[model samples]
Target: MLRIIGFLLFASFFSLKGQNVDFEYIDKVYVPTIKSVTFHPQGMGIAAPVSDVEGNIPLLLTFDELTNDVKRFSYKLIHCDFDWRPSELMEMEYINGYPEDNIQQYSFSSKTTLPYVHYELTLPNRGTRWTKSGNYLLIVYEDETEKFPVITKRFVVVNNLVQIEPRLVIPANASLYRTHQELDFVVNHPKLLIRQPAQEIKASVVQNGQWKNAVTGISPFSFRNQQIIFDYQGKIVFPGGKEFRPLDLRTLWQRTGQMADLIRTRTSTEVILFKDKLRGEEPYFQNRDINGRFFIETQDQNNQLAADYAQVVFNLYTVEPIYDKDVFLLGSFNDWSPSPEYRMIFSPEEKGYILKKPMKQGFYDYAFATRAKKEEKLDFMETEGSWYETENEYQIFIYYRPFGARYDEVIGYQVFNSKR
Candidate 1:
């Protein structure tokens, strides 16, 4: 019975793929060209001219047919739901080639200076409105018939007023510091506080890791230019209470000797293990009876040499194996998938589950989620720092430039103050 259900599920998944349009050059060149192109000040009801060269108007595309004469060349802009599913928000614009038609079109005459194309479109004010601020794609198709190459460009539309900018402060000149050393930096403007209630702040730090919570003893400091002090006196720990550290350019060279040796040895077996040992001895593996292993992996196919995949390995221990157990690995690694990836069986002897996934090479904050009957809990053994629930510090930067100006040639900038 289970086998029959599985086969049906597989067939349904493949059937969905068949419904998609088969535009040969869609993903190859068109997608890249759209992505490489940029638009300024993007948002709802916002319109900005598209340009390839920074200051000038964008060049109209011109295509020459090698074999057959090109007929009825046109384009359309399709807006779908957040998931790109069939949405009421979708709209199509006709790009007519010559002005002779009542429909908008580009005309070429003897006076035409260059062989090019031009198009302009204004999105409708009505229909399903964009509710959330996020990244979206603008798909440009050469022909409404879906026969020619189609291009897609990704853009961000921020609909909300609240903005958050976070920054990390390390010593400007010095790089190396002894393990468990105390460091201090000033948090200026609307002073930053440990994200915890005043009375329970200390207890939270002790229960979680010290690094997870901001250091205490900050009240005496003035809010005008608040000072933040961090004490790494216990052991070297990754920030943001993440289970694994990102192997990016900044920290790649830092992994040395025993750490390097461990990664080299265990990479094929489990590539996500961190080499440097934490100061006090603690059991690294958990969920033994649950039959699971947690680890990290990268998503990038090219540049496997660079840190890309960070995943968790799960080893299930039960004889009457649990089927379809929704195991979620949470850490600073995943954005704390309120819900995350499903488990997969790797090998028979390794009869547990693995959540091997790729991550970009950068520091992240994450945790794990497991279900027992009807309740959910975080793996405290793998968790660090307590959520004090206090206001944290954040930095704000505003960069401005005129329409026909270079990005770096900033006309002005402003910094807003915030506590947390």
Candidate 2:
């Protein structure tokens, strides 16, 4: 019976490949050689991948190619609607310059055992710039054609025309008050003209930039005097998950956080993290985390080119295998998307869930979660427990499509904290 269930899980995950990642618009790396993919505002490597429509701080996209060979890569941005589907608007409508251009800025690795090339591209550079504010997908491909995409990432361009007043609300339900958090917010657009304030104004609330758990296309709860409110009783609630477990791989010389053993080779380094435990039954303890984000850096070098990659082996020790669900590693490094590559398999001999992944030297924050065999939604109660007092980052995006607008316009964006 275990074998039969395992087969079903594997088959379902593999079926997602039929979407053809080369054309799919998502935050994913299609090639095995790409590592440490990040898209964020310029000068701020750890910020969420959001930029103002004014283009003062262009979005920066960076990645490491785990090879020495030089490859010609070109990139393009696709304007998407509120739901992430391509707007299908002409290229001239959303882009100010050429729709596609080559990625010419890169640096080769220096004094590192594992050779890699660091590539950087700033949006709104000399080549291309965004003309409209909305959802966007950055596609990097070979030979100037998106049909051979190597990586894809999602970023947002917003032109602030409204004010978002967000407040973290405690759930009123007895069962949810201790484990869940909710958002109560309002949008006031004083400058923009709107015919249907409740019908046209929509909102999306995202927690920790993870779209898998985001509430999208939300209608206004009430409206009064150019203000739209969203107080969903308990519908806009999220698990107040505990602070992510910290992992420090800044250097291989000294022991770091959770590093049980380190094996160094002439060409590579391997890390074995101490076994992780289920924290659901334990009381929540306050800890510092990057809010589930990672930044690539090395103490041994001044720049990113000298950072090395390590094969990390993670072991999660559960009382027994979760026979009904599949486990996966969740973090900003993978855009919090659970896939076969990040899935943890149960090891009989080790009596735990184990996953091996190659990651660049950096400070990372991560947690483990599970997905049911028949559903895509992930649950965290089995590994990292939830608590109402946990600190978390919330991103609120307000999109407008007044009556005749062809595409959704991102009129407001806000990033706030629960404990603030």
Candidate 3:
């Protein structure tokens, strides 16, 4: 049964190989050496998704190469439709400047045991600027070749043609009331005209800053007063996931918030975190969390471009090893995507699961996520637990496709917090 289920899940992901766009990819790196990758609005952290096509706001792309030597890296942009496939528009139609450019801004790690080169690039600069408001993919590759991209991150550009007002409520379904949160929104398009609310207008909603399970292809059940309403009967529901687990790596010199031990060596520094508890047995408790977002901060330095990196070690103890599922340390550090580096391996000697990986110094919010080979859902039941009152962030995106248009335009974008 598990094998069959696993095969189905694998097939579903790769089925879009020839499709125009893929939204399932959150933040992914093609190579193993690439770490501490981040792509967001210049001053905004990973939580915010506001970018202006007027060149008022630019995205800051940064990543670290573990290799000792520096390499020439280049970047390009792909304007995607609302579905996240490459749009039909050509390069000159969407970009004002050249299509591609080399990343000239970078710095080497300072006063750290792990020698690496950090690269940073601001999007829509003088060399390249966007001309349209829609979904986009920022790809980074070595040298001038576009064959194999080292990193691919998604971002959005909005011109704000419409206004979005969103509301969160307990799901109408009795079975999901305790563990689900539903979204109801209204899109007011005063200037833009939509021919069909059901077919021409499309909406998507994402919860807790993760796009893995975002709800898309939303259709309005009713329209009135020049507004489309998305108050679905039992749709637009999301898991009221528990508050994220916090890790404070701002400073490594001494034992910090959750630091169990800090081992210093001539070549590198390693940090050991205390064991984590399984929350399934306990009642739900509300805690302040960053909703799975990450922010870069260095203790000795203010500029994140030159922040020191560390080899952080994570330990999660279990009474007995569960052989059916795989445990992973999930967060924005790896774009909330599953990878071998963040997987925890069970150890009989310690009676726990352990993982040690190199990460840039920062404050990160993560959780222990378990996935079965054949299962489609990422279960937090045994680790983080589900609760209705867990504060989560939600984003509403509305895209419109005119009758004669070739691509979907982002007519409206808004983000709201459920706790508020």
Pick the lDDT winner: 2
| Models sorted by lDDT, best on top | 2, 3, 1
Candidate 3 lDDT over 1-420, as tens digits, reads 999987986675454233324223345787888888877788777655558769788788888998678888887777788777777776767888877788999888776777778889998888999898888887777873444578888788888888999988778999988888888988998887777778888988878657678898787878986899988868998878888889888887778978888888787788888888887666778888888888878886666555667778787889787669999899877877767777899988877888888877888998888999877577888887787777888888888888888777887889899988
In order, what lDDT does every prediction score? 0.28, 0.87, 0.80
Any residue pairs clashing in model 3, and if so which?
20-85, 21-84, 21-85
Evaluation by TM-score, superior candidate among 2 and 3:
2
* 1 against 2, candidate with superior lDDT: 2
Which ranking of candidates, highest TM-score first?
A: 2, 3, 1
Which candidate do you rate higher for TM-score, 1 or 2?
2
TM-score of each: 0.28, 0.92, 0.91
How many pairs collide in each candidate, listed in order?
43, 0, 3
Q: CA shift at 3, candidate 2, in angstroms?
A: 61
What lDDT, from 0 to 1, does candidate 1 have?
0.28
